[model samples]
Every structure is written in C-alpha cells, then in structure tokens.
Target chain A: MSGVRKLVLLGTGLIGGSFALALKRARLVQHVVGVGRNATNLERALDLNVIDEASHDAAAAVAGADLVLLGTPVGQMGALMQQIAPVLAADCIVTDGGSTKQDVSALFRQHLPRHLSHCVPGHPIAGSDLSGAAAAQYGLFEGRRVVLTPFAETAQNALEQVQTLWQQCGARVYTMTPEQHDGIFAAVSHVPHLLAFAYMNAVLAKVDAQPCLDFAATGFRDFTRIAGSHPEMWRDIAVANREAILADLKACASQLQHVIALVEAGNTEGMEDYFATASRARVAWGQRHK
Target chain B: MSGVRKLVLLGTGLIGGSFALALKRARLVQHVVGVGRNATNLERALDLNVIDEASHDAAAAVAGADLVLLGTPVGQMGALMQQIAPVLAADCIVTDGGSTKQDVSALFRQHLPRHLSHCVPGHPIAGSDLSGAAAAQYGLFEGRRVVLTPFAETAQNALEQVQTLWQQCGARVYTMTPEQHDGIFAAVSHVPHLLAFAYMNAVLAKVDAQPCLDFAATGFRDFTRIAGSHPEMWRDIAVANREAILADLKACASQLQHVIALVEAGNTEGMEDYFATASRARVAWGQRHK
Candidate 1:
C-alpha cells in the first residue's frame, strides 16, 4: 500500500499525537500536521517530534492532506468536520478516535455527507488517566484493540486504508456496525465508569465519609479508580450514549435491589449463590484474559 | 513485654498462618499450635513452619495455651469458641481476625462470657485472593492496618497485649467500638465488594454477555476485581454486617437512580457536576494516600 502523502490530525492530544508518532515510526506517513486550539500542546507535540508541522486552522491543515484523524473529544468532532468539509481533498480518508461511534457516525453524515465514502469512525481502546500532547508515545496503541464502525456508504478501500494504518501502529482492529459498537462499549466501558462515580457519590453521602475514606483499602481503591476520570469527557459519554447507558444503569440498579432483598431475608444460601455466579464467571474471564 | 508462652490458632488458613509466622519471625511467641478441621491443611501448616505444632482438636490445643487467635470465617468462629471455652487458660488473651467485629463481639460475649476481660476482637486489613497455609507470608501485615474492638469489659492489659503483638507483627493498630468498625467497613470494604458482585451479575445478565466480556478492558478489570472473591466468605460478611451493608447498598442504588435521571433528561451540566465532585474527591484521596 502507498504511504499517506500528507496526514493531518484534527486535535493533537494523546490520541492524535500517539497515532502520528506510531505511523511516523512505521514510515507509513510522509508528513504530519497537528491542529488544535491549545498552542502550548501543539508546540509540545512539535518539540516531541509527534508531528512535522502544527496548525491552528483545521480547514487549512487538511486542504491537501490524503489522511485526516479526528482525535478530539466527540463533542468537538462535528464542528471540526464542518470546518474541513469544504477544503478536504476529493479522497482524503477521514477517521476519528472517539470513544463513542454512533455520535461520530451521525456527525460524519451531518457535516461531511458527500465524503461518507472516505469517512471511517473508529475507537481505539487505549484509555489512560493522562492526556495532552506530552502524554503521547510511540507504543501507545501497541497491542491495543481498535474498533472501526463503517457506515453502509463507506467505501471498502477507505476502510481497508484505515485498518492497515492501525495495523502498522501495532493495533488489533475489529469492525462492527455503529449500533453494535455503541451498545458493546456502553456495557463494558461507559456503564462501569458511571457506576464507579455513583458508588463514590454514595460513599460521600455517608455521615462519616472522611473516616470511611480513610479506612478504604485496596478493594475500594481499585473499584473507584475510574471515578477519578475526566469529568467533561465522561459527561459527554454519559449524555451522548444516553439510551444504552440508562438501560445498563437500570439493570445494575435492579441487581442491587435483588442483592438487598437477599440480605434482608438473611438468605445465606441465596446470597452465596448470587455471589458464586459472579465470582465464578469473573474468575474464568480473568484467567482467559490473563 | 514478655512473649506468649504458647499460642493456639483455631483456624490454620491465610490469616491464622500468617499471624503465626509473623509472631515467630518477631520471636514474640515460644510455641504456636495450629488447629483446624482439615488434616491436610494442618499438615501443610506444619510443613511450611507456619506452626510449631498441629492438631485436629481446637479444645485440646487450647488446654494449656496462653493465647488464642480465631482466624476463621465468622460462621465457624462461634463453634470453635464454644469448643475451647472449657479448656482455655485462666488469663489467656483471646482475639479473632474476623472481617466483621460486631458478630464476633457477640460470640465472644456468649461463648466465652467468663473470659470477656481477656477477649479482644481484631480485623487485619490484609485481604488477598489467595488462601490456605501455603499462602501465608512472613510480612503479610507489615504495613497493614489492624482494627481492634475491645469491649467495655475487656481488661486494659489484655487489650494492650493483643495490640503489642500486632505491633510486633508490623501492623498499625486502631481501636473502636464493634459497631463503629462494622459501619466503617461496610462503607469501605464490604459495600464495594457487594457492589462489584452486583455489577458483574448485571453484566452477566446481558443478552450478549460473552461479547461484552470479550470487549471488557482495563476499567472493567479493575472495577470488578473484587467480584472474584470467595463467595462463602462474602456471604457470611453480608449477613454478619447486614444492617450497615443494606444501608450503603440502598444509598448506592439511589445514586444510580439520580444518574439515570440525569442521563434521561440530557442534563449534561448536571452530569458533569456530579462526576466532578466524585472525580475531585477521589483524585484528592489518591494523592494523599499515595
């Protein structure tokens, strides 16, 4: 496959900068352009050699680029797509690193309707507590899973190009529909984060919240680690994928209600049974994953 | 302070075996007697040098012992306490390593009424997935917190002796009422565990559970790590600490309900505010603890 002549990153944070670095290391892209509102971050990306050039204007950056990666938060992707639509080349392959696919897919359809054939909405499952261009590294996507959700109008050649690029970055790629991608993420990532936030809030509501926190050990630490995630990013996820997230939250609430009933009735056998099912499945999953 | 002449362990598992090993390393105990129902486990304890002697009979083992540690599940502690009550030495310092203290306090009151002055209930916060005598380590409690709940009738010297021994084992000891210990633990350890179990079960209830599990990444792994805990052990804790666990679980459920409402109403700012509170507090706690 021919390498990208010019690759543009719409937002040069960890995700976009890391992608640029990885592709640069693989020699799959000739020149990289990073576009973001943060001048300091763009300067850091240039200092770190994550991108060859930096630009504040998205439209100008992608004017003649063969590849464009929308690595900003989902909330910012629509305006970015609208800004670059008029200046994009005839076949500039546009993809994104959004956490949610359905929303990004809708944005592609809304702002870049004529460019659907070249747009591939994707999510790279490399979540981290760190951000900014300084957090980017060449191996960030190595061994990570990336899910691509291509709409019906997306060209097969465009999809293959994105997949091959992610492969060059040492990522394992899988393809699914936008709806399937949203639902699966809602189950595994989105809902667990929301649950952790809720659990933390509940602990805070306690009369002895400080003492309770003081006594919290490893179990509490690992369980609520995600509760310390970026508030704006999670708020976007919680609202953007509202229907899927609400369904899982309701299911979790119902499960808690069942647990309460069992505890109230002093049902040792039932409680053991409930816990055993979860423990057994979790243990099996852990062994397999490990 | 003088060392214990002979110490009896009524349950020779991780907690009990680790305590025996720590005391031996400190040269604070002249003799350690491990007693349990499983002959194989007792033999393993002896082979591992975690115990100086092994016995199948708790009553027989405590006949001439100056100290006794009930290092078993809460459900089995009562039976062992009753069995050793008639044989216990007059001034033997009896303590337990149970997770929940209120029930153990009640058991000490009922089974060893005459020995209340010598009884000090303790909980070592060194939880691990591994168990059995082989899993015992020399410094399992080196930097762990050990909470001791000594009743009003407990002799100062007896409590001091237990506290001193734990200090020798390299544990930081804190004293509180049994009720306070249970409530604080329910908020931190017990409820987080129960919440994890409920979350795992909710995931298992999904129609595409396997696919969800396949796609589960780091967040799910950390969030549900405690769900793989021992079922019978957690069941006993849930029942023994029923009132406090139920209250926290209800509060957690209510929090989830509020989150659901925020999502349903598309209240992005409300969601952001709710997440910010938790994220800020958790981040602060992490920094302080680290």
Candidate 2:
C-alpha cells in the first residue's frame, strides 16, 4: 500500500538489470537492490547504475523490500523462493521474470507461507540475443507485452500493484492462467527457440563434412543468432517446460512431414498452395504488427 | 580486358537494387542501369540513386552493358535469360543474384550464346526480410559472403573479373560446384527458411483455437520474420532446389524424431544431454561466425 518504496531484484542479469534501469528511469521506487550468485556481475550492475546497491545475500537484499522480483532461470526459482521466504516482509509482493509460469507459481505455493498472498507471476516478453548486465538497456520493455499469471488466492491489491509497476515501465499487461501462458509461449516462443537450436545443431554436426560455416550468409546468421544464447539457461527452460515443449515439437514435426511428403510425392501444386497461404498470412500479420 | 564500365541490373528489387548501390559506391562501374517489370519500383531505384537510370526493356538494358546481373525470383531467371540473350553483347559478362545456382546455370547454358563464355552464375549470400529498391543500402554487401559457381566452360578471365567485382564491392567470394552450393545452402538457408515458414504456418493455424499471436515475443518474431519474405520467391526456391531441400528436410525431421522420442520416453538424462550439446555447439558456432 506504500507504493512499493524499496525493490530487490534477485539475479540481476539481463532481465533484472533492464527492469532496474526502467525503474530508475521512471523514478518509480525509492531504492533498487540487486542480488546475484556472481559478485562480479553484481558489481557490474552497480557500476552500470542498474541498481542503487548490490548484495550477494538474497535474504539481506529482500529484508525490507516491498517488492522482490525473481529474475533467475526457471529451474532455479524454487530454491530461491525458499531462501527468500523467511526474509520477505509480511505485505511484500513477489513476482518473477521467468519464461515459464506454471513451475514458478508452484514454487511459490509450495515454499512461501499461505498467508503471504502477494505472489504474482509475471513475464516481460522482451530481450535480445545479448545477456548479462552489460546487455541491459533502459527501453527494453517499451511497447512490449508483459503477462501476469496470478493464482486464485493471490491478493487483489498485490496483483494491481504489480500491474501498475509494469504499466509504469511502458508495458501492456495481459492476464492469463499459468497453464495457458506456458502453452501459448510453447507454440510461439519456446518451440521456435528449440527449433532454431536444433537447426543449428543439425548443421554444426556436419560442419566437417561440408563448408557450411564458410558459406553461411546473412539469412543463416539471423536465423541461428539466438541459437547462441546461454546454454544453461536454455537447458533449464527445455527441461522445466518439457510437456508443453514436446507438444509443440510434435506439431512442428507433423508440419515438416507434411511438407516433405508433398515434395517427395511431386505434389507441386499442393506445395505451392501451402507456401502461398503461409506467405500471405505471415506477410499480413507482419504488416499489422510492425 | 578492360574494367567493367556499364552495369545492368535485372529485377531491381532488394538484391538487385542493393547490388546497384554497392557497385556505385565502390566506383566499379560508370553507369548502373536497372531493369524491372514494375515501373514504380524502377523509378524508386533511380530516385534512391541505387541505379543511374531505369529501363523497362530487358533487351535495351543489356544491349551494350559490360555486365548484366539477373536479380529476379529463381523461377523467372530462365525467361529473363531468354529475353536478354539476343541483344546482350558477345563480351558482356552475365551473372545472376538468384538464390539457387544449379537451375540458373542451366538456364544460362540453354539460352546464352556459345560465344558468351563470359556468362558466370553467382549468388550473393546476403539479404534481409525487407524488399524492393527502397530497402537498398550502399553497405548491404559489407562483410557478407558471395558464392560464385562457374561452369567448366566459363572463361577464366571472366571468372576472375567477376570475383574482383564482388571483392571491390566488399564481399568475401568463394567458389564451389552448383550442387555443393545448393546442398550447403539447403541445410544452412533453405531448410531453415522452410522450417520457419512451416512453424509459423502451424502457429497461425492454431490462432483461432488459442490466439498464440497475442502473446508472441521477440524470439517468435525473429524466428518467423523470414516466413514473411516474398511468397513467390520462396516458392520458386523450394521448387528449384527441390532435391537438396528435401534432403535437408529429411535430416531435420530425423533430428526432431530423436527429440520427440526422448520426451515421450521421459528420459531426462537423454533430453538434458541432447539440449546441452545443441546449445553449446550452437553458441560456439554463432559466436565464431556472427
């Protein structure tokens, strides 16, 4: 109710660092504290003015904070919830910047006290291929969509406060169930990433057989650029959201099979028709959104 | 034996127009002539200074040019070659900016005069989702790779001249057989585009059921951006390089099957190992090249 005076951003990497920069630019909170496993990264966050102070102790960082934003990998959120549970204030709000929502929400429910209905799961759908505090920018969230998945028992006030924070940072907020969030992202975001990674892997596996790397063009670079993301981070994402990711993989494989069959069967007309429809739909979608 | 003085660029879209710009910036040609079906785009090319003049007549554009660059869709290259062959000078070096090399080379062999050993088939492995002369920039080819697939009968002096031209325009040139060129690109470029297009189509098909587009992020946008490229152009590429594209698709499908089996079997160790290997290899490859 005191307008979220003090904020602790746990795991001040790209997401958390960007959030801190946004908060500072908007002058939304009194103090911003950063917590991370690496002291060097924490120091870099402080040096870059992403936060007012840096601390390695999660408990100490969240001690008096009104908002604790968990910005760690999806697989690490559960253990972090337990570590910060005892130190979080009675009325403090807990939110996250993780990609998956189902697992994060479950972690909160299992670790945090039930009376602490301030847990609100949020994901700001904005990032670049670059990572860490050095890659953070002030307007990273501008004109981006941030989804908030609140449990049924979540405090109404806490949810509104979290929404306000995102809005002030220039993000359009959408509310959905955790399952729906994961499913949608699996189709649009997670699956696309996995596909890119898989594509690069397939090519690199044969790097010695052909001059694939030497002959790579701008198209290859752009398509596989994100494949260069943090391996540990992506591995966690793949495992944590295994079910939804597999569902997407199934859909993708079936689509690939259909195209392959059309080509193999010499169904030129059908193949052309398929590409035409996809091209038209995608072009229309891009024009509208861009 | 003299340096190229006049350059004629056919189908002055993104690649053609960009080539024109690069030639002008490098001062490699005295005049740049643009040929296209669309008068409006030709005018845009002239206004943007990508070309010194615009001509709708293919024969007139190639009449006295020292070099002619075909920049149309792969499907249209054959017709354009036939149209320009009669008027092209005996000494004029005709090359192409098409994606697939084997088919384009076949067209040149069929239509080009026997005296014109000057005809060399080429593909500049650079482009963006943007199209038309309006999207052209002078630095488009800087630091990009250009593949030149010369036939056995190709004049040695003419091949060297073409290589020098691309080098002057700030591109790294490499030589390969048309088959090797198509096969390598199918894995690194064509198949990736097909996968992106197919994946986007899959997501769009489910829009009615789930509205996944509403929550799409940068990852999805980047992955599917190529899907929005000219449908007719991609359609031509898919058909022209059918064999290599099919091979790449089969390989990708098998890789997806491995991932699918792991997920279905709930083999966490296998899944982790697969993703970790993919992520690590992709990251290393991306960093080295990108």
Candidate 3:
C-alpha cells in the first residue's frame, strides 16, 4: 500500500470507482474525491462509497491531493489535465487509466509540460460493456494486467507509486514503450473490433439478413459479440489511434485479398493449408493460455 | 420415441456421439452402432454407452440398421453414402449431420437415387472445440436448433421420423430447402469461421504476434475462439459451400473497403455513423434473441 492520504479520481466510473474500492479495502486510501461531468453519477459514486466526497470541478478536487487519477475517456483527458494543472500539489503524482497511451502521452506533454516528472502514463486493461460507478467492484482488477508506459522524464518514484497502487488493486504490472503498446493492441484489439463492425455491416447488406441472423448459432454470437460495443467510444479510439489502426486494417485487407484469390480460384490445397495454419496456431495458443 | 431398432452412426465424434447419448437417455434408440476409422474413439464410445456396439465398416454397420446417420465430414460423406447404399433396406431412413446441405444433397442424389425419398439432409447447429466420443453428453442438443433440409423427393414420413428423433433429443426442428440451408449457413456460420481464420492469420503475420496474443483479453478471446476450430473440417465446409461463401466474402471485402475509405479520409462523423449502424443492429439482434 502507498499509504496515500488524499486521492482524487477524475471521471469516477467503472475503472476509477473500482480502483477506489480496492484501495479502500486495502486501507491504503484515507480520502477519495470523485469528479465527473454527470452530477447523478458523482452522487451515486458517493452513495456507493466509491469516493468519500463528490465534486464537479476537477481542479478544485485535486487541490490538496497527493495522488490524482485521470480515468476519463482519452478524448476528455486533455481538458481535465489542463483544468487541474495549476491547483495540483507540488509533489502530487498524476496517472491515468486510458486504453490508448500515445495520444494520452501527447496530452500529458501538451497540458502539463512543467509537471512532466509527476505525470505517469498507465493503462489498466480492465474494460467491460457495462459502465457507470455502480458497476464498480472490489475484485474487478483481480489477476488483470496493467501496462505502464512511462517517459524518460517520468520520475522513478512517481512510476513506482502508481505501480504499487495497481499491485495493491490485485493487478500485475508490466511496462512497455507507448509505440510497442499501441502496435500490439492495434493488432489484437482495435483491428478485431473494426473487422467485427465491418462483418456486421456486410451481413446487414444481404437481402436475407434476418433469416441469416435468426439461424446464426454460437459462432456468430461469439465473433460479433464485440461488434455491439459503444459506437462513440470505439469511434474515438479509432480516430485517436488512426495511424496504427490503419496499418493493422491494411494487413487484414492484404490477408483477406489472398484468401479471396484462393477461394475464387478454387485452390483447395492452398486453402486447406491456410486454414490449417491458423487453426493450429489458435489451438496451440489456447493451450498455452490454459 | 422412435424406438429405432438399430441406429448406425457413421462417424462417432462430437455430434454423432452426443446424438447417440441423447437418444439413449430418451430410450428412443434400442441399439446404436458406432462406426469410425479410429479404433480408440470407437472403444471410448462403447465404454461411455454412447453406442451399444462399435464397428469400422460402414457397409457392415448399415446392414441391420433401421436408421443410418452419416455423421462424417462433408468431404467424406459421399464415400460413406456409397458404402451404405447397397446394404440399406428399402424401409431404412438415411439422414446426415453435415454443416452444408447442397453438397450432401448432391451426394444423396448421386449415391442413393433409388432411395431419394428416404434420405434427409440435416445440420444440427451444435459445435464445440471439444471432440472425440468422450466429449459426448446427453443434453448436447437440448434447446438447440436443428435444420432439416429435405429434398423435393423426400418422403413426408421420413422427414417426420427424423424430426421426431431430434425433438426426442430436446431440439427444435426447422424445415427448409437444401439451397436455403446452404445460403443462410454460408452467410452466418461458414463465413464467420473463414473470417476468424483470416484474422488469426493476420495477427500471426505481425512481427510481435506472441506479444499481441499475450496481451489479448476477453474481446480477442471471444473474437478468435472459432479460429481454433478443426482445420480439415472448416476447409471441407468452405470448399463445399464455395459459391455462397465467396459471395459473403466479397460482400465483407466491400464493407471493409468502405470502412477503410472512411478511416483513411479521417471522416469522423462518417466513421461514427458506420460504426453506429453495425452497433445498433447487433444490439437489436441481441435484444431480439434475449
């Protein structure tokens, strides 16, 4: 436990609220201030004991805090960072719970240039379709991974503090460069979401789509599960991480083209080998995970 | 209860094994002859009581069978149909559990022209990563959907018998033409498996694939779950349903191209609308399903 006396949470929803609850259970956090745009949500977080107090003004909330966590959408982090810049304590350490890191790193650079060493960029890989402070729970981060991408200017002590906090929240922490993090996540996460969306749109284009969907079984259900993601959030992530996502999508297109040619030419052997490679790899991958 | 005197299963694997177990529990099947190439799997089926007898010869197995189920891969079904043709009795009803119906329909026409009325082509939408006779369960098809694609020459009595057997296994049976079954499944089932294969292959093409796989969470898990499917099985389905699957693949490629254009142009609102279209439809589909 970091023994942090005062901690402020910006955008007290699932991630932030859950963090507060975990640390409170550890007896590490004495006072927590929840800041959010939605007054109803802030009140709920307070009522649910996700925070000791609630405030709409982020800058005012961070006034006497030793630690401040920015848990809003990547799109909203810049404004929040700009708001809390002047009022943050001299030694206050600021970290975030954003999915994408490169843009958040850029935001930190732009908004708090003078507070560079105190700003530690981190992402806790715990997101669900469910949202709101009411969805927060103590064990949300249990056995989950948290990736921290700290810059050269990021103070060693500040990084460790945030790392310790995540550890106390039952998460294993791993550190990587922002570029590597974005590239890896683009291949695995962002690109899959885009493909699922595109696949859903393709099905909707068919004349007999309703019948197709009605007869769809478990495979269709699992493959398109992420296609029902929040549009605004996915759109923001897509636009925010445009370059890496475009590269991933282009790779996917290239592969799809090869597959299309094989199918069009009726190359049974080539198609079999192709499907075999993927299936073997996936089965091997699952075995490793298990 | 059909009280099938002797039911012969051509391939005693997941689908066939489970069906046998379900029928045994229902007391609808008096005896089940499990036929497969693998001796160990046959012994396991017998030990598990999924079948009362085990045999390697398809022709020998069907000699006394009142009901014969061709439960092998679509690629192997034609040969099995040929093997059982000479031995099948005039009153014996023949059905299959192939994923694609048109090819199986063709096999029925080619190998059993004289017995067309007694042949029924069916696809039970129950698939899992687990295989072998040991994975069989009594309730595998309970509350599951079974599509029966009866031909124009199919006898009403034969279709009803097969339908009642599925109902006894606790499945809801649906009737359609073989072409309709192929088209709908091509759009939903076949295409999604191919897409998942393509996506997994794309990730493998990346330089940091293992790292990407390492960091992948729930979204990636569900998205790529079917990628771990049986390679030979999927290849057979893909090639067997090539025409319909090709059309679906083309539509998906077109949708991906459109998404790429939206993303490349950085048209935020356009991208949002595109994502929203897919997200809305998926959510609505899920709601209707629930």
**Per-prediction TM-score, please?**
0.94, 0.92, 0.96
Q: List each candidate's DockQ score.
A: 0.84, 0.58, 0.80
What is model 2's native contact fraction?
0.63
- lDDT tens per residue, model 1, A1-290: 87998999999888998999998889888999999999999999999999999999999999889999999878889999999999999889999999998888999999999999999999999876567899999899998899999989999999999999999999999999888988999999999999999999999989999999988888888899999988888988887888899899999999999999999999999999999999999999999888
- Give the whole-model CA lDDT for all candidates, comma-separated: 0.92, 0.81, 0.89
Clashing pairs in 1: none
Order of models, best DockQ first: 1, 3, 2
What's the C-alpha lDDT at position B31 in model 2? 87
lDDT of 2 at B228: 70
Stretches of candidate 1 exceeding 4 Å from the true structure: A1-5, A24-31, A43-49, B43-47
TM-score of 3: 0.96
TM per candidate, chain B = 0.96, 0.96, 0.97
**lDDT: worst 10-residue window of model 2 chain B:** B206-215
Runs in model 2 deviating more than 4 A are A1-3, A51-57, A207-210, B1-5, B46-57, B207-210
**lDDT per residue, candidate 3, B1-290, as tens digits?**
35799999999999999998888888888889999999999998988889899998999989978898888888999999988889899989999899999899999999999999999999999987667898888899988899999988989999999999999999999999888999999999988888899999999998899899999887888899998887778878878888999999999988998888888888879888998999999888888766
